[model samples]
Target: MVDVMHQEVVALENRRRLYTGLAVVLLIAVVMSGYHEASQLNSGGFLQGLAKFFDYPAQIVAQSWEDGWAFWALFPKFLPALIETLNIAAVATIIGALIATVLSLLSSRNLEVPAAMIPVVRRIMDVMRAFPELIIALFLIFVLGASPVPAAIAVAFHTSGALGKLFSEVNENIDVKPLEGLKATGSTWLQRVRFGVLPQVLPNYSSYFLLRFEINVRASAILGFVGAGGIGSELSRAIGWGAGNEIAALFLLLFLSIVAIDQLSSYLRRHFVGAESFG
Candidate 1:
């Protein structure tokens, strides 16, 4: 019996090794075929694009070096555009967080609600998250005549869905004792949620909101490229005119703003949510 068991174990190990090897081979084959197809479809072959990738950056740097004085001059010219982009992100994040709060509570299982409504609200959130912000912004730009307002609304719509799902997940894990105590007092649903749930989850919610704000700032810039109204629009114009010197300046400003925002949000998240949460 001992000999038979040892043989069976060896056979099982062999089969496991075989299966793992087959899986690795299949994955490699798939990756290679996908890369080949992509290269075939690309306007420039993969190797060709890779070789020329540094050419544009080299030109921009050379131009900026030659006309470095214009770099400082362009900063004031574009300051308002940067402010507009930040405004769009800030407004969108706030609006999205507010909407998410209501949806999250309604969708949370621990919270009291009509059973049918839960799936309805969840589906709405699903639809919201499924649409990309860029597509929404383009559609809105067509309707609303290309302003920051449309970009804000588009970003907020997507943010609401994204944050609502996260908020609901946070709600699911909160302490229940306070909620039970609130209910025992015959407290209203809103009262119970306000006093019981909000305190426990607010840190997590705020952390997520701050992260979303960082993302929306970048998204707002991209939306401006499509005619939304921000530094992106100005950047687009510079590119169209082949103003490499101006492009370098705009790039520098954008890069600095993004890094500053990232650091600030990271610090705030660590302070509010605890470092372990991010880890």
Candidate 2:
């Protein structure tokens, strides 16, 4: 009986290994084929482009070094645009997080009041998240006429969808006892969610919100390249005019701002969510 059982286990293990090996080979083949197609479509092929990848950076650095004083001077001139980008990100994150909170509660299976609205809310979030912020910004820019408003709206739309999905997943893991107890006392659905759900999930939600804000900051800048009116537009102009010194200065400002935001958000997330929560 032991020998028979051992043989069965060995056969199962072999079958699993066989399936895994085949899947890995298929993945590699797909990747190679995709890369080959992309290389063919690319103007100079992948290898040729890869060889010259550092040339632009080298030119920017050399020019910036030659005009070091001018590069430093660009910072003060560019400060307002940096502020505009930050403002867009901040507004988007705040508005989107608020919307996400409401949608999360409505979509969560455990906390949803209507039960039937789960699929509807989930699908709405899916649609919202499916469109990239850049695409939304471009469309809005055409209608809204190239301003930070379109960028903010675009980031906020995507943020709400992304955070709603995350927050709903967090909601699903909460203990049901508090909710049940609140319901037993004839508490309103809103009351139960406010007292029972919010406390348990606030830490995770805050962490996710901060992370999303960091992402939106970068998105806001990128959207500006499409004439959404922020630092990105300024950067695009510098590049178009071949102002290497200005480009370097703008890149420095963006890099510093992103690093500062990342550090601050990381600290806050750690404080709220705790390192152990991730483990």
TM-score of each candidate structure, all chains considered together: 0.90, 0.86
The prediction achieving the highest TM-score against the true structure is 1
TM-score of candidate 1 on Cα atoms, chains taken together: 0.90
Off by over 4 Å in 2: 1-45, 276-279
Candidate 2's residue-wise lDDT over 1-279, tens digit each?
Answer: 999999999999999999999999999999999999998898899899889999999999999999857679889999999999999999999999999999999998888468788999999999999999999999999998999999999999999999999999999999999999999999998999889999999999999999998999999999989999889999999999998989999999999999999999988888998785332
Q: What is the lDDT of candidate 1?
A: 0.93
Candidate 1 residue-pair clash tally: 0
RMSD of each: 2.3, 3.2
Residue runs of model 1 more than 4 Å from their true location after superposition: 2-6, 30-44, 274-279
**Which residue pairs show backbone clashes in model 2?**
none
